[model samples]
Target: MSETNKDDRAALLAEAAGPATELPPGWLEVVSMDMDAQGVARKSDGKVVFIDGALPTEWVSANTHRKKNNWEAASLMAIHRESAQRVRPGCPHFGLHSGACGGCKMQHLHVGAQVAVKQRVLEDNLWHLGKVKAETILRPIEGPAWGYRYRARLSVRYVPKKGEVLVGFHERKSRYIADMQTCKILPPHVDAMLMPLRALIGGLQARDTCPQIELACGDTVTALVLRHLEPLSEGDLARLRAFAAEHGVQWWLQPKGPDTVHLLDADGAEQLAYGLPDFGITMPFKPTDFTQVNSHINRVLVTRALRLLDAGKAERVIDWFCGLGNFTLPIATQAREVLGIEGSEALVARSRENYEKNQAQRPVQQALAATSFVARNLFEMTPEMLVADGVADKWLVDPPREGAFALSKALADLHQARLGAEGAPPLPAGAAHWVPPQRIVYVSCNPATLARDAGLLVHQAGYRCVAAGVVNMFPHTAHVESMAVFERA
Candidate 1:
């Protein structure tokens, strides 16, 4: 073929294979939103596109940058259609701009509507993935939608080209840090200190050495664990001390993993702590403690779990997967006897210390004196262990992401042996029938595990999923925190 003929054909093929370099101005009708909050719309050539920063029912001009088989990803060039529900985000850092904060995705949607969307996400995932449905829905537990986050791990980065240091969350759709002065999701105290953090990190001698900051807020104290890549200089250590004292924050340094974390303040007095004032209990741990991020939701969840347990002077209770005595101490208050079991020996030890702390302060220690804790492989807990532990009348199951599938199944098997008419394996051959709790309140971070565990409780353990509901524990993200009540059928 002639060179000119080949060139013409290649040019034509490239034009057909790639998206048009220029898009004609036209109003794009919006449809539904994707998981990332992008609005789905069609282009001038009838190709569907996902438009960022566009809400449902809103028309916009989208510039396509990437094309997919069924849809193209675009950035909103202009909004031609607006929805009545769309309102200006109160936070200036919100949007799809180059350096916008990625902490919040539903900032454009109203808080009420956010709850509805989360509910829909939860219910849909349950039906689609688990083929299960709850007969009753508990009222969506809601809390302060703004500045409620008490836990966060903020990223830190330094760029020579930008000639600046950034200390915050990553920017939307990018790896660079968000050039943000404040965060709307942080509690007022921490949110107001964003600029101070920037200035503080800038002042530290280990400014570049520090790569992250972990924030943990208890009822009265705010702790920050500076994740340092290099050992801090004496001068840097002093600076951290001053910053902690000046800002009323606790500071810890991590040169390695969590075990290397240590307090930097004078007298080493600054320790991460959370208090359950209702239980008159206090827990002291490192900033790396896996406490709930939303304090309000956790408080409510604990109260509900205890209420469902119905612990009283005569009733015994077991708090499985107890962390820092969150529910164990509270259950100890009402139960005749409470046994809190945990897998992490460190967590179990902390729980025991917390119970001791509770006992030392309260006169009721001598009066109640019913709670004790044990560290065991709860993930592998069997009917023998359950019976050996002396199963209580009520149980609170709070497992991690893997969920308590084995433990739940064992509980079901124990119930079968205890209530079996006769000759039913005789309690694992010589082992007594494992103690079977009358009711179980299961708290789960993963819905699939919860659904699976709930199925076992209902079908095998003779309990019914009486109530289930979602908790917006980690707001503005897809993580669904839910609780379920299982009553004997």
Candidate 2:
């Protein structure tokens, strides 16, 4: 854990789980990286082993821990030959214990090496999960390495004996909060405010009452949503308001779950807003609204996506999983028309609101004439629903961790049927002449889903993954964020 009593950490761990495992003689060679960023190897007894805190291209001796029939897991014991890419981590707290802040992984690897590993992870997943190969590999998109996180949810816990309250991310491999003074991933301002936040929390009698603080920073506002397990007392309310005023921060309160998140001082004229200045669109959202944390890379990504898609005046486009119109509103400024589809009705309404807000101030003659949004159950989507939504000339999909498997499959069926000469074409008049969107841009948060959906798009849908690349949205951790471009055959 990040916070250690230092008296008996090893002893406590031993008491809890008794010396996880023993290291076998003869060092095993690490062949590859598994789903959890662990190095994979095997022992002579046919037991596969995974070593935590180990990377690819490096051979390390490890202590075996968890075991299964096909695979056994291990922790790094000794490095026989370390990769040249290994570098000192930027954050001091980045290791098994003192450095263990469950927030980031792969920090020990060089930044360039990190990107390369992410690309490899994406390629491996696509080939293994989807059995599809990209015709071209686009250069990985990159951005600032530090102070990029604009969305965060910090865990709050109090320790009366120490007369302190810890506020930061969770501990490595555990639910406890990491005792950290600052976070490198957060925006510069938020990172600077960490210790002050801890102090604020420590001062409150309701220190234990408040369990979380969700953060979202926009161009105009930095909203803090406090998640409290119990109701805040008048004293706690005053303390929070004082903290907010002192820090120039907007405060929100959640007495219970997410549904209870509300502005604590709304009349103070606070609105959280993120913007795509290139598209001349500013997106206003509640702190709870789902948006990518890395704004610098998001800008790069959207620009790259539009360039690859080549959305233009002659074509209309659809933005699937268009949460809060992040990509939809931007795409609208380039394409002739745009249809944004989302999973939540509230988000759909927000998208429409954002569209109108941007349209009124649209630059250069309102590049796109009209744009709209609809809420649909994308995972359970059917061909009929695809037809109902109106198939556009091109597609831009930015799904959640769950990729667009159902929608891609449904589109494939409709496209094939339309070409089969006996089935009805999807959407619009002169259905027979309707051709499926010629190109599709898929933005994915999870490589597995991307690979699975790519399989359906390539093998089942008569499309080929023309180009795919990785984007390190969350730089520290093993989580891989990627994008792929598919073209119809």
Best candidate (score: lDDT): 2
Q: Which portions of model 1 miss their true places by more than 4 Å?
A: 1-84, 266-271, 365-368, 413-427, 430-432
Off by over 4 Å in 2: 1-25, 44-47, 416-433
Candidate 1 lDDT, 111-140, residue by residue in tens: 766666666655644554445576788787
Model-by-model lDDT, in order?
0.75, 0.80
Candidate 2 C-alpha lDDT tens digits along 1-489: 111221122222223332223344657666555556666554555455667887766767887776544555578988877877778888866786653798887788788878887898798778867898899999999888889888998988897776789898887888878889878888888998999999998887778888889898888688899888878789989999999889889988888777788888778576788777787778888899888898888888888988898888878898999989888888887788898888999899888888888777756566555888888889998777777666588999999887898998887777666566356444434445446788999999998899999998887677989999999888877888999999988
User: What is the C-alpha local distance difference test score of candidate 1?
Assistant: 0.75
- Candidate 2 least-lDDT 10 residues: 1-10
lDDT of model 1 at position 115: 66
